[model samples]
Target chain A: MECMTENGGYAAGCRENRRDRATMQSVIPDAIEVDDIAKQFGEVRALDGVSFGVARGTVLGLLGPNGAGKTTAVRILTTTMRPDRGRASVLGLDVDHDAQRVRESIGLAGQYAAVDESLTGSENLWMMGRLTHLSQSASRSRSKELLVRFGLDDAGDRQVKTYSGGMRRRLDLAAALVHRPSVLFLDEPTTGLDPRSRRGLWDVIGELVADGTTLLLTTQYLEEADRLADRIVVIDQGQVIAEGTSAQLKARIGTTIIEAVFADPASAEGARTLLAPLGELTDADDGRALSLQVNTGPRSIMDAVGALERAAIEPLTLAVREPTLDDVFLRLTGQRVE
Target chain B: MVPARARVRRLTLGWTVRDSLTVTKRNLLTLTRNPELVVFATIQPVLFVLMFRYVFGGAIQVPGEDYVNFLMPGIWAQAVVFGAVSTAVGLAEDLQSGLIERFRSLPMAPSAVLVGRTNADLVRDVFVIALMCVVGFLVGFRNQTDALAFLAALLLMLAFGYSMAWVFAVFGLRAPNAETAQAAAFPVMAVLVFASSAFVPTETMPGWLQVFADHQPVTAVVDAVRALVLGGPTASYVVTAVAWIVGIVVVFGTLAVVRYRRVT
Candidate 1:
């Protein structure tokens, strides 16, 4: 916040700071770099001057709602689609001129499970291995290794059409890894999975990150981004609206939210009126839940508690919670992440 | 030593062939695993053979050969053309399922998917045509030519189907889904199959219709196959048929590859 005054203004100072960092990081360029890329389909602009970079061996979560150009960005980076404008690169190779080399260095698991349903899991992986130029023996061994790693060894012989949604996704991810690519692009990898399956996938991703795999994950779930991302870039309507660490982005709205749920709307209204001076209050559904966003740290909760106590209103629940990525998304885009 | 650029080009060409064969193997494996598909592919041609031979055999006439002899080659040509429709549907299914995107993102050859799919369909055509020939034999249709000539007829039919596969490959990439691919391909198939001399003699048709029926590629291929099989002067029909096949392979092969590039 002080940089606003020190560097003259908000937008200019932020841009200057980013330029400085980018210059510094240019010593070792990002593993994945997208520079001012744009794409259009008929009349709809799918991606409009979007740019971002992912450092090596770190996770950069691309957060957005549907139609936010996340998949288009992935497609461009994966060399499946070319941008109408601008350039992208993977592992220091230009994606357009050296697309084959770029493909050799990156793996992409698309929004849908792209595994061949008619082929067994092992066969699918083996085919990917062969296509990536692995020898027959190497491909066979890698297929077995990936099936075991993804917990699909027992089901490896069965056709992919027989596998569950989660199993199919795992196989698809494994197929992408057949060449042991350095950079991975997962577009909504857990979109349709149940909670348990999503968690299982997150664990696999965690292990990959631990093994120093650079990942660019696009996700609609703010929780998924918060849980996995070291840095986050939020895009909406084909543009980057905000980007930072989860805590940094959350700080844009407020540091903490003091929430209180009353038994009735009358009690909530009374509490909101009494606590009006504490900070900014957003009344929740049906007016039974009230949340106060306060930049003041722990003391803000004490202030809210003292105010409610002074008013003689008994609330149903009261808790001080850190602001979530959802709050940042709502503040930036004026809509929920959904 | 070879220049680096030439060496890289050679390696790329080598990988293109290898990748195409790998994909062809995958498609053939899928076909084998789905027994119902094999059953239906064979059954439809057999049904066509039986229906035309028994149901419509009595009314049709050829100039010199038995009606069954003329009918068999036409049926084989029709079977091969229809077999190519499955190429369209299969490719469209891959597109809808995101399998094509997956393949495109890999480091493999760009032309492999289309080449592999058409080649696999050609193999399936061979199987279905062989069964149709067996059905043709049981129903009193016999080839008047030697074994080598019969083999040449078979090869010509496969070449015709191969060209149609390239044509449908373009339709598949243009369509949004498998059902749409089938819908778009069938009407064209009907036009080619019926407007030609596949089911009846072009000479028996009215004068204007005969002009089209005589010149269309399907009729040329069918007439070529009939000449090779039923013992006649094969030179002109074979020349025209080969010209059509080469022209279609050049034109539609380019269109299909272009459409594939624009898919994602």
Candidate 2:
């Protein structure tokens, strides 16, 4: 919220940055387009002119830290909340005017398990089916099938309150898919799940995407997004910071990394000055070791070692590796991707 | 073949009914599972009716064989009013459980939810009225108005019960939590109990209280039910009671719908 108070002179200086590209047209695409979406909670702008799109049959993961605008975007797309400024559409239908149609085309598994605890696992799905306007016989049949597919057939008769968290989450997912929606929305589905349950859900999502479900998943875990999403759109403070495939984003910074590990202190200072002209040197731990970013392959590592050897500086360990998405995020945002 | 649109409409209605019955069944199950709640829900009306009938029946005379007969209609209306709280409390529980948000995500009709809920409450309220009627009869009260009149009295009480539902539904929706709804129900119910002719004749009250008891909707409802079921009063009270039913229904019903949309 303090960002709003520091804007009088800073806004003018920001306008002078002329390097910002005119990327506004990208917000007007057809499948899922949001333009100038802004929302204010008192002095806090939850979404500050947020804009983005996701094409049909493509999985776009909305990635951000906690309290980011990812959930707000999903809420707007799911027709739960409307933006204060811009508009949003899902599958060519406006979220506000065509909310029913939008809801019909999308299935959402929200952050919490939304199932009724008193109802049996099968009854929960049957009740959802009834809400979807399915025939009684058809609803029963479909509910039974989803139960079997989700490996919940054995516990179909038990009340949901008796089930474990993983079982409940699985049943929740099955309930979301009962309508056979074309697009599925999952907002931090794995936020509270253990590792094994999360992996099981990952498999379920992988299968869903493989069989042609256009999934828009919002998650705080970069690894989950990387494993499940074909493309990720990183959002922070209600704006899209970056959007691309995993490999495409990693390529933003150079691919190769010359990581030098030191056994003890007092040796990395000599290595830093020796390799400073060849590449940017980052001290691994103050003066313990030296790491560098490079555009070339293992040749940079060899040159650094030759330079350090000529300078009579001894290094304990050296390695050449490719940078991960975490490194790419740090390079762009100047903070760890927490 | 029938058109797809027709199928969807038919299915939506089917779903609404199914959900409503499911909710009613759940409430009934709560009573059966914890039989103590059954006694607790009926205890207040039973206590109030007894206080008015046997405790005060001989002192304040109506032109009926037993003063208990005159008290039955007033008791019925009050019991039905108490029963409307179930709807509000049930809705508040659903809100607390996040079940309403689950329903919101589905392709369900917007109005179907409240409609189903209000309808289910109607059934539960009527059932509670029947139990009160049985209790009244066991205590030596007889209905001189016959079976047809009894049915008419029940329907009027149910209609009045149906109208009072709006007041609580609003509280339930705006209530930040389920406990808020439960806490707010008591004083409101007490106000209606005090203002109505549930205990004493409106003519015998003090001047200002008489005017209030006369103009109050609950008094009109109680007087009408008394005339129909016990049949000592003139036909005018029945006319006034139906008017009260319609008037409260129109105003509070609209308010309930508006508040529902606002809170949701």
- Candidate that scores best on TM-score: 1
DockQ-derived CAPRI band for the predicted complex in model 1: medium
Error of 1 at A146 (Å): 1.1
Worst 10 residues of 1 chain A by lDDT: A3-12
Docking class of 2: acceptable
Candidate 2 is scored at a TM of 0.81
Report chain B TM per candidate.
Answer: 0.94, 0.83
**What C-alpha lDDT values do all the predictions have?**
0.86, 0.74
lDDT of 2 by residue, A1-338 (tens): 12111311112222222112112223434457677788777787788888877765567788887777887788788887777889887777788887777777778887777787767898888877777766688889999999998889999988888998888888888888887877788888888889899878877887787676778999988777766676688887777888886656777775577888665565676677678898877666556867788775667767877997898777677777566667866776677765
Model 1 per-residue lDDT at B129 = 85
Clashes of each: 0, 0
Model 2, B136-233: lDDT tens per residue? Answer: 99887788878898888888888888887766776677777778887888688877867768766777788988887888888988888877876666
